[model samples]
Target: MAISKKISVLLNLADLLAKNKPEILRKNELDMNSFADMDESMKDRLKVDENKVDGMIRSLREVAEQDDPEGKILYDFTREDGLHIVNRTVPFGTILIIYESRPDVTIEAAATAFKAGNRILLKGGKESFNTNTYLTELWQRALSENGFDTHFVEYLNLSRDETQKLIKENTHNVDIIIPRGGDNLINFVTENSSVPVIVSGRGNNFMYVDDDCDTEMAIRLILNGKKRISVCNALDKVLINKNLPELKEKVSDFVSELHSKGIDVWGDKKAASIYSEIKETNDKMVLFEEFMAPKIYFSLVENMNDAIEMINRYSGGHSAVIVTNDAEKADTFMQKVDCAAVYHNASTRFTDGGQFGVGGEIAISTQKLHFRGPLGAQELVTNKWFVYGKGHVRE
Candidate 1:
């Protein structure tokens, strides 16, 4: 397919979605009405409103406006045998995305893949079947209007067993698999898929407040990190340097602010001793858990080394942050932390495709194989080698 056609499809789809906002809302309502027995956070993800629709539209338009990623030459050379060689970007052929909730994935992710000249196979959770199918219809309509095959984007509404079989067997001949959800969904894909899987969406992210850090900035960052509990970038843990000046006073101020916001604060022994409002815990497992709720964890570390070690061991490899005024300390933390996006004197909440200026992302790839960080349209492609020889024979 021509690149122009791909861009047209995305822009047209955005217009279609914009004109049919009511329909999208109605479909979302249908899904929400039938859905039952889910946590508030899950419900928030499943539900789509005017703003999310606007966001989807903006993402489509942004993607359409970007340069085509396909066929960009990486290298060019002439061999000694007079053979011409070139390497250019190429799509992954087909991608299978298995995700939970968040029907916007049907729009944003598919637009990116299709823009890069890849067929998309989306398998959203059953809870979002209505919205997913409706959005996919828009994609098909856009493709058809542009004289392209509707199969460029496809939706798979399969049973749990069927999804499992497809992942394990590669029934659709997909080149890459991206799973967007909590650990369970990501784990299932990584452990069972026949093809390479990009692990994403888990965020037991941590922040370290150094002794020399700006106290007010640290507190502000912690609050902002918890601003949205349903996102993968939400803060889960905070490790304060034990040498922080007036540690008790600063921690108390932090706890008081969090309480005013209705967020639950959990702490380890040292942390709880500093703030009476913190609910202390000894369960080591909480450190490994991604609390997609109005909750956060606090622990005190003896030094920068201890803080870095703790973050490396317990974080979800999604993102980590260090709040410090010392440039050297910040640099060391950013380098030593093993997360995909490390922040120095910044909030972990910025670990997003849009924030990182990728238009939008298929996923924030935590694994480092093909690509890392935001997997945008450009990142979604592999490379191909092209050679031209004029009847050259090997000597």
Candidate 2:
């Protein structure tokens, strides 16, 4: 399809969603009412209000306004034998995205793929069946209005056994698989998918406070990082420098702040020693766990190196941050932290595709294979080589 046709489809989808807000909310409410016993984070992801629908519309329009990612020339070469070669961006054909809840993904994520000229096969969790189905119907409507096939955006309401069989077998032609959920889902797709899988790993993001950092800024950033408990970028751990000024007093102040916000503060032995209010945990395995809740783990490090080592060892390879005033130290930390995004004096929550000005993202990719960081429309395409010759043969 032409770029204009693709943009028209996205714009039509946005308009349709805007006009169908009441129906969309009704579908989401039904899903929410049936799954009342779910956790706070799960409920948050499953719920869809006017604001969430507005966000979906905004993202779709943003994607439509941006330049198409496909057909961009990457390289061009010519040989003396009258042969020409060119490499250009091309769609990945079909992308199967399996996600849990977050009905917005049915709109926002699929917009990026559709804008990049790829067919999207959505496989949302059972909890979001109604909302996902309704949203996908809007997508199909937009596609049909543009004189395109409705199969371009399809929703698969499959059972557990059926999904597993499809994942293990290449029954449906899928180019890439993106699993955006917890470890169990990611592991299942990565282990069973016959096609390439883009693992949108856990959060478990970390932040380190340098001895030379601004105490107030560090505290503010840490607080903001935990503001959203349902996102993959939420802060889960903190590694404080042991030599920070007034370390004990500062720890107490931070702990008090966290408590005021109803956020649970867990601490290691040294961190607990600094303040008795910190719930102490001696288990080493907690460092690797992604607590998608109102909980954060705290530990003390000897210096920048120790902090860097601890973050690299325990983080989910998603995002890491260093709160420091020292430019050189911040640079070193940003360069050394092995994550898709590293921050200096900023909250890990800012590591998002929309925040980074990419409009919408298919997933916040943590793996290093096809691409890293936010997989936006531009990153969704693969390069193809085009060769031209007239009765040319190689000797």
CA shift at 385, candidate 2, in angstroms? Answer: 0.6
The C-alpha TM-scores of every prediction are: 0.98, 0.99
**How many residue pairs clash in each candidate at the backbone level?**
0, 0
Q: How far is candidate 2 from the true structure (C-alpha RMSD, Å)?
A: 0.7
List the global CA lDDT of all models.
Answer: 0.90, 0.93
Give, for candidate 1, the lowest lDDT window spanning 10 residues. Answer: 194-203
> Worst lDDT window (10 residues) for model 2?
164-173
Model 1 regions more than 4 Å off: none
Q: Write the per-residue lDDT of candidate 2 for residues 279-314, one digit (tens) a residue.
A: 999999999999989999999999999988988898
Candidate 1 C-alpha lDDT tens digits along 1-395 = 68887888899999999999999999999999988788878988899999999999999999998889999999999987789999999998999988879998899888888888899999998999999999999999999999988888999978899888999999889999999987787778888888888777588999999999889999899999999888889899999999999989999999999999989999998899988899999899999999999999999999999998998888889999999889998888889899899998889999877788888788888888888887889898899999999998887
Residue 15 alpha-carbon offset, candidate 2, angstroms: 0.3
